[model samples]
Target: MDTLTNIRTFLTVVRAGSFSAAARTLDTVPSVITKRVDQLEHQLKVSLFTRTTRKLDLTEVGERYYPRFMTIIREIDDAFQDVTSSRHRIEEKLRIKCPTTMAIQYYGHILTDFQRSYPGIRLELLLIDRSVNPVEESFDIAIGALPTSYANVEDIPLCPLPRIIVASPTYLQEKGMPKHPSDLIHHDCLTFLAAGNRWQFQGDKGPVSVDVTARVSVNDSHVLMHAVENHLGIAIVASHIAEPSLRQGLATEILSHYPVPDLWVKALVPRNRRGNAAVEAVISWLKNASQPAPPWEQIPLSKITRQAPS
Candidate 1:
């Protein structure tokens, strides 16, 4: 006999007070209900009902078990209703981790658009550019150029990050341009200390490593960009950040010596929680959004409209 059938028979008989009454309530023959209750008694090794021609009553064993069964049945029904309710309601709190530099650049519009689209979801955005462990940090999503050294996470690539060197035309003209990667040593340079002052490139010979010397150094890319604009020094930075300056003829790109490693805008989500809806939404939006080149790759500064900083 089916397992749930016995449980249903127990519930019906207890509520209706007789096998005949229960069969009428269940729309099944009284004998069928009797057979199911008997099967349950045999499985449990305990008789569940005491019967007479005049009345039906619970056995001593059945009395003890009856309340538990009813409680469990109620719980099961409540659980189903809870699940159904949650499925219809979309309210969820979303938390995300992002690179500090990119967060300041891209997150403003993303958060505004997401809030308008998903009013039911609350968001927590955390900015962490350097090394971060998502599991330790308890974040729902991580956004950055995914590190290859990462372990046990879902790394979803969002966009391409073309990196290159940019310098103010005024600064470049004052110091003069470098003819080769080696010539950079003589010119004033703005550098990223995080990159270890070693610029890796794909050269005609295959791969080349150039250790650049800089007059000024900064850990932050955004600050380095500003330094270059202020004529503090020439800086190597991403194209998108330098787009406005490049358009206005403020900055110029240097030597065709080698190809810089492309930055991959990627999202790192916890492997255990990869199926979350909010994480999926941000990942999808990042993929669909416009991705412009980092300053040094495409059109020169002269073509861009110049807007002075407010």
Candidate 2:
């Protein structure tokens, strides 16, 4: 029996959920897949899976062995890639998680460019607006505007997500503009669900927080910008998300003197993937894309800036 081959087949069966599915993934027949798993089970003198006509499930020993097998496979792949990377193109799979708004507005092209450059690598991108546990989700990398540290994950800072207060020209004309963070309380404020009714800022004095009333609250940044364009209310939004509107004169920045606190876009990598070539390459590519300044920040904001609050 080819021990390594049988072990790989066993892992594939576990991941694909059935012999037929594993056969399709491995480009073989169900009988071959079944034989490999059977051989692996016989070698170990234990049953790895409980089979039923309806479904397949792992036994307790199999559950304990899955992670160990995954680690072994990853180590072998990483070692081989590292040795050949200088001479040959990297061939691997990378699973990435990112926030929905950021992916649509900014990272879509960046990711596309990376894939174009490394045609050998396969990318699986999952778009979500919530924090994800990279290890638990089996993702190689997770990107977001995370403010706090997570255990067993290394947060590599990519760039600052500077934000600004914005309102439509028509809305500003009707409701008037906010001169300070405190003025927000009197306006029809739009808030992100994560931020609640309170908005944070930094002034020359120090940090400031204001409790404002929101007629509209949403979790998505793009929708919040749309609300601003529709003259729903004043909102604090990421500078990148608000850039196009600000440039096109659809939206105007308010309270420029009091800068909103910056959220950082970071690459959250699991500890085990620390030295992974593909992960490192992706991180480097992202950092390079943000260099000098992020694409949005690089634009001349001469028109976007409002006169300092009087």
Candidate 3:
């Protein structure tokens, strides 16, 4: 028996909790998985799992051995990555997580360009709206806006994404525009739940806050933008989310005199991943794409007639 392969199969089965699931992950048949596990058990002279119809449970020995095996596997994989990364060869798989709206609107081309530039690298991109702890989630990289301060991870600032108040022309026409931030209380606000229930603005005098009562409260910025476009109400959203509408003349900026606090587009990675070549390359590419003004701020509302890529 190939000890390494058998151990790998065993770990896979343990993680998957079934021979069938492990087989699917390993691209082998369930019987082959069972045989490998049986071989491993015979060699060790101990049963690793207590198998039952409903579930699989680890035996005492298995529980102790699992952590040791995990460390060995991780060290081996890291060794390979370290060697390849030193050569500047990004030939390994990379898992990335990002916001759904940003991924569709901005990163579609950036990712394509990166893939074309590095054909040996395989990419898996997962889109999510909520905050994610990259280390806890086992992601190689995470690209999104960090709403709050994060100290545990390394953050690379991509661009300034200031919030803007916008409303559809029809909605503004019907509801009338607010002259000041305080007047926003009278208008129906389409609010992003992530930004919280209050909107902040900096005017000539000082800062102002408006407690938002929403016509529609949503987590996704894109959904909130859609609601604004459909004349639901005025919304405070990221510049990128409002850009398409502002460009197409579908929505007009409100409270232009009051500037919102600047937000940012950021790239996050585990602290230990600072020197990772693949991740560094991605960060460099994203920084380049953001320079000379990012895609969101590049196109003037006057010139953009067609909708931006979804």
Candidate 4:
């Protein structure tokens, strides 16, 4: 057998955790798998696995080399696929992770449209609400509204996620409107867990931050908006989430003069996958979708305008 085949067999054995399992996966006998792994280890001059009758474990050297070997194989496979398929007909499977709220509110159609455009590409999407290590989790892409600084990962900014402070008309009517950030202390504020009680904004004087208390705190932006609509309290919500309510006159924007801080939507891609054709295509697609201005920003904020209290 060739060195490349032996190396592939060794990786399969490592992933399967046993010679028998690797054989089953490759449709061969355990002895063949064992011989292949042995050949690979001998060529490398290191014992790759610490083997036992019950289980198989990678040695220290094996653990260090595994990721490098995996990267090499991925690049080789991607190259073969690129050469064989037409430029626009690239076939690959992409594992993507995105925030649950964003996925529900925005990405449903966006992702479906991408699949339609690239029929040969298969998408496996996981909707999560927190930060995850894409490399460790084996995800091709991870999208979120927060900035990330991870080693061996590339952070690509997708768009700016502007926010607005809003409350139901009924709630504002009953509680009265606050002209300034300091006045938020008197109202029952609905806060997002990630943002906490302190809300930051920019105004004529300078940056202002208010340490307000919350009547109800939640992680989901959609839920927070729902609470605001139900007259729960005031909340700092994403512009997109609050748009519909403001347009319907169900909610009113407050502190319009004091703009809330904008969070950026970013895509986290592993360094090894940065050059991958499918990953590059998806990233390019996102950029194109968000360029000039995002879809949410396309609608005139003037349509739902509310004058700031003086």
Q: TM-score, each model?
A: 0.60, 0.63, 0.64, 0.64
Lowest summed lDDT window (length 10), candidate 3: 300-309
Model 3 lDDT, residue 176, Cα: 91
On residues 1-310, what C-alpha lDDT tens digit does candidate 2 reach at each position? Answer: 8988998998999989899999999999999999988998999999999999999999999998889988998898899887556423778999999887667656776888888877777899989887788988898999988575678999988888888999999999998878889988889999887667778888999998999999899878878888999899999898877877898899999888898889888889999999987888888888998775874665433433433211
> Candidate 4 has what TM-score?
0.64
Task: At residue 62, give the lDDT of candidate 2.
Answer: 93
Find the 10 residues in a row with the least total lDDT in model 4.
Answer: 301-310
Candidate 3 structure, TM-score to reference: 0.64
Residue 187 lDDT in candidate 1: 73
The C-alpha lDDT values of all candidates are 0.72, 0.85, 0.82, 0.85
By summed lDDT, the worst window of 10 consecutive residues in model 1 runs over 293-302
Model 1 CA lDDT for position 27: 96
Residue pairs with clashing backbones, model 3: none
Question: RMSD per prediction, one decimal?
Answer: 15.9, 19.2, 19.1, 20.1
User: How much is 77 displaced in model 2, in angstroms?
Assistant: 26
1-310, model 4: which lDDT tens digit per residue?
A: 4887987998998888889999999999999998988888888899999988787899999999899899988899999787546545788999999887777556655787787777778999999877878999899999887655688989998898989999999999999999999999999999987667889999999999999999999888878888898898999998887887899888999999999989988889999999988999788887877777874565444453443312
CA displacement after TM-score superposition, residue 270 of candidate 3 (Å): 1.2
Q: Compared with the true structure, what per-residue lDDT tens digits does model 1 show for residues 200-268?
A: 667787877677777878666767777888877666788777766677777777765665778777777
**Candidate 3, 291: how far from true, in Å?**
1.4
